[model samples]
Target: MERFYRRDFINTLSGVRNAHLLGTLSYKKVPNLGLFNSVTHIGATPPHLGFIMRPLTVPRQTYHNIKAQGHFTLNQVTLGTYQQAHQASAKYEVDEPEFEAVGLTPYFSETHRAPYVAESPIQIGLELAEEHHIKANGALFIVGKVVEIRLQSHLIADDGHIRMDAAQAVGVAGLDHYYRPEPIAQLPYPRPGQEDKILKPKNN
Candidate 1:
């Protein structure tokens, strides 16, 4: 294991998806949006996920969109969509619509009116459930119940895992470093005497 400490890595390690953060504004009010480095999964049994959005200290678009529409989509961005993902993160003026500015397509979630990235490989429509205020950084942690989920057919795996590497999943480190998939250890991750099989497989 490598050991070095310069600063507590500025990562949004909170459990959530690291996808392109998608949000919807209004009927006549287009949403002011940006991408997030912090996102993750929360539950599987009940099927839920959330994003840690900043508070209303300076008028948060995601928070306001959630409050007004009660809906938002967390879109997972990957290498295939890297250009738009980085382009959308620019802090645009309040009056401009990010989708319009960046030329990204928006899809109305069937489960709710909130919009999602049409070009994204995976998108989840969420209804706001809870807002946790983390005052230290003025970040409002958002919890949403999963009402809908959309994904490209090729990304789903038979083992019930989203082949993240093949999906080209990206991760953010510190303030601005972005990371794509990297090769790690191979599968069959068990050592001798560490097997948990109580019964042997019988060829019938």
Candidate 2:
């Protein structure tokens, strides 16, 4: 396979991925935002999240800021902010903050030094916990502990699952294609000798 084609094929093979806007702040207080599809839930006991970052062959402001500042924000991309979120991935000058260039509002709170996207429906503030550098590729595996979460009260369910459909959260396929997911059904926990039943979809 050709180089570009191989890259695209491997990226999309994992199916749809949650699109997130990662916000960080430089030591100089310059807010930076970047679009990422690699965010993954690591654990719940201590509330940890991990994301894969590209190899730092060049200056990666997000990585630099997170390492230097020790905090970052993970904001869910919504339909309204998907375009701007994608645009945030562009390479900009070290002094030029992506938040200003992409036209997204940068929000800050007393609890965190990093900025969050004001347009994002679900915002998570995290404190840098650990970072692992892959030997084969210089990619960094960043782990952060959740410090704060902000979202609409109605978007969460009693079971703790966020109603993503109601939030209009967007997902990415391959690199550029975006999609909105619909909830199909919610099923009960599996038990021994339990009969299989078709669960009804939630009313959105």
Candidate 3:
């Protein structure tokens, strides 16, 4: 495949991915925000999350800031803020903070120095735990331990599942496209003997 075609095809082939706004602060205390779709949960026991970042060949401010401060934020992108979130991806000068350039509000708390998106429905504070260099593509895999989470109370379900639809979280189809997801159905936990029983629809 051609370079442009291959890039788009490979990205969209993974289906919808959670879109997030990564917030970091430079050593000079400049706030930065970048849009990313590669964020994923790594573990639940210690509450870890990881994201893929482009190589350091160029000045990747996000990578630099995280390394300097050892803290960052992952803010969920929502329909209301998707456009502004996408705009944050634009390559800006080191002195230009995306939060200010893209017109998103930067929020700070006493516990973390990295700013969070005030518009985001869910904001997570993460402390840098580890970083691995991917030799194949020269990408960096950054892992962070979840330190704080801020969200609306109603979005949490009784079973502990977050109602993403209620939060209006948006997903990315590829590098540029954003989408909102709808819930189809909920399933019960699976077990050998309970497979058939669990498959049955619950009576409202």
The top-ranked prediction according to TM-score is: 3
TM-scores for candidates 1 onward, in order: 0.78, 0.93, 0.93
Alpha carbon lDDT of each predicted model: 0.72, 0.91, 0.91
lDDT of 2 by residue, 1-204 (tens): 999899889889998888999999988888998889889999998999999999999989898989898999999999899999999988888869788788899999888888999999999999999989999888989999999999989999998999998899999988898999989778679887776464464775
Question: Which 10 consecutive positions of candidate 3 have the poorest summed lDDT?
Answer: 195-204
Count clashing pairs, candidate 2: 0
**Over 4 Å off in model 3, which ranges?**
194-204
Better of 1 and 3 by lDDT: 3
What's the residue-level lDDT of 181 in candidate 1?
A: 63
Deviation in Å, model 3, residue 191 alpha carbon: 1.1
lDDT of 3: 0.91
RMSD of each: 6.8, 3.4, 3.1
Q: Compared to the true structure, candidate 2 yields what TM-score? A: 0.93
**1-204, model 3: which lDDT tens digit per residue?**
999899999889989988999999988888899889999989999999999998888888888888888999999999999999988888888858678777899999889889999999899999999999999989989999999999989999999989999999999988997889999989666778875565555675
